[model samples]
Each structure stands twice: as structure tokens, then as C-alpha cells.
Target: MDLKSTVASIVDWPIEGVIFRDLTTLMKNPEALRESCDIFYERYKDKNIDKVVGIDARGFVFGAVLAYKLGVGFIPVRKKGKLPADTIEESYSLEYGSGTLEMHKDSLDVGDKVVIVDDLIATGGTAGATVNLVKKLGAEIVECAFLIELPDLKGRERLNGCKMFAMMEFDGE
Candidate 1:
């Protein structure tokens, strides 16, 4: 499916000088949504992933189902104070300022293989922060997966030391 067609772009949303490529349109289309999940499942089905960790909010949409298809576990790395019980958090820089993300302290184990998923990779701040949190548990990162990638932002640079996969890339949007 041409997933890009199902995406809608909004200029200067939530902030000026930024164009947000929204995926809600694609998500609502059953064919597009299924294709999106199928793409991720195909890549990781044989990777022996022990867990699928998703960033907060939108990431949850894709990450949870992918974990189910892979027959593994799903973990959510949410905004600070979002998770109950004892948690480990990491702070990272964003385009505007900074933010903190947290994950349950006991969600992972040493040497466990994990795949991080998110709706998109923009500046890579959130994704990178999640990666660091996973590392604290000594889990091996199988790869970082995303449905869309904006290459102009150099987000992947911050994702060094981790393999990344994106279904599609939007440049000069």
C-alpha cells in the first residue's frame, strides 16, 4: 500500500516553522494499518526479539500490536510520572526544550533482545532517550523501527549504535 498517500501534512502545527506529517489518516485505513504492521512484523519475526518497547502516545499504537504478532512482550516508555511503581527515567533534549521519559525498572532484564518502535523519527530525541533507558537494563537493541522518517532533521545521527528501520522517508516536505 502507498502509505504516504494516507498521511496528511500540517504546516506549523503545535509550533511554527515545522510541518507535521500526521499518520492518523493512514492509521484509520485498515489496509494501510495492516500493511504497516505487517512490514514491521516481517522484519522482526525472525530476530528473536524478547520485547517491543514503544515511546509514549502514538508509539503505543504500533508497538503493542507488533509485539503481539511477534509473540513477545510489550513495554511502554512514557513521559515522566506516567508509569506507576518504581521506574527508571532518562532526560533528553528536544527541538524546543527538554523532556523526561520513564520505563518500569523491572520491565527488562540483562541480555534481553529488544526492538524499539515509534510512529515517527523526527529529531530522534525521544527514540534515543528510550534507547538509553533500555541500555540501562543491559538489553541488546535489535533495532529501532519507525513508520516514517524525516531525514532532513538528522535524527538518525542521535540514534548511533543502534540499527534503525523506517517504512518510508519524507525529505524536503
Candidate 2:
């Protein structure tokens, strides 16, 4: 569906010398959105994912829907204090410094298979933190999925030994 073309390129977004790949344009188009979701669903439908862990905000958009489509539960990996119940938190480095993320303490059982989802993969810090949180809960991460990947940042390197998938890849400003 050429989903990348549907995404808007924003120069110097959120910071200087950084180009943001905005999904709002692609998400607003029904065809592209549906196709993107369908592609993810089809790929992981047979992976027996017990839970789909979405990392905050945008991840929740497709993560919840993807979980429903696969008949699994959705676990939110949010910023600290967002979840009401007891939660497990992990702090990781960001491009500038550090940030933290949390998930419900009981969100996954021992040996439960999970797939982490997000809108994009940048430097892999967030995804790596999320993976650690899932492991600490005694759950196994089967795969990581994203809508877009900035290959130049080598985000996938932080996910060594874990299966990862993405719909599109870009190396740009």
C-alpha cells in the first residue's frame, strides 16, 4: 500500500536536525490503515501471542485493535504512574537522557508469550526497556512490531536475539 508515501515528513520536529515521520496522514487514510493492520495481523496470527504490549500513546492505537483481532489481551506499557494497579517499572536511556515506563505487575503470567507493539522504532531504548519489563514479569517476548523503523539508528540492535518486524524502514534526516 506504499504506506511510507502516506506519511508526512516533518523537518526539525520535537528537536533540531530531527525529521519526524508523522503517521497521522497514513492513519487518516482508511485504506492504508486497514492494509497496514491486516499485514501485521496476518504475520503474527499464528504466533500464539498471549498478550500484546503497547508502549504508550500511539502504540495503544494499533496495539489494542491488534490484540482484539488476534483474540488476545492488550497490556499497556505506559509512563510511570499511569496504570492504576501495582506495576513494574523500568528506566532506560533516551536520545537526550533517560525515561521510565511501567506495566501492570500482574499483566502477564509465567511463560506467557507477548508481542510488543509501537508506532515506530527509533533508537531502540524504549523497546528495550519494554522488553525488560515483560521479562521481569516472567513473560516471554515472542516478537516486536512497529509501523515504521529508522534503520540508520539501528534500533533493532538493542533487540538482539528477539524477533522483530516492521512495515516500513527509512534512513533520513
Winner by lDDT: 1
Per residue, candidate 2 scores C-alpha lDDT tens digits across 1-173 of 68889999998877888888899899999999899889889988999889999998889988998999999999999998788999889998855457899998889999999999999998998998999898898898889999999998888888756889999998874
lDDT of 1 by residue, 22-87 (tens): 999999999999999999999999998999999998899999999999999999999998888899
- Reference-based TM-score, model 2: 0.96
When superposed on Cα atoms, how far off is each prediction in RMSD? 0.9, 1.1
Candidate 2 weakest lDDT stretch, 10 residues: 90-99
Reference-based TM-score of each model:
0.97, 0.96
Candidate 1, residue 173: Cα displacement in angstroms equals: 1.7
lDDT of 2 at 131: 91
CA RMSD (A), model 2? 1.1
lDDT of 2: 0.89
Ten contiguous residues with the weakest lDDT in model 1:
89-98
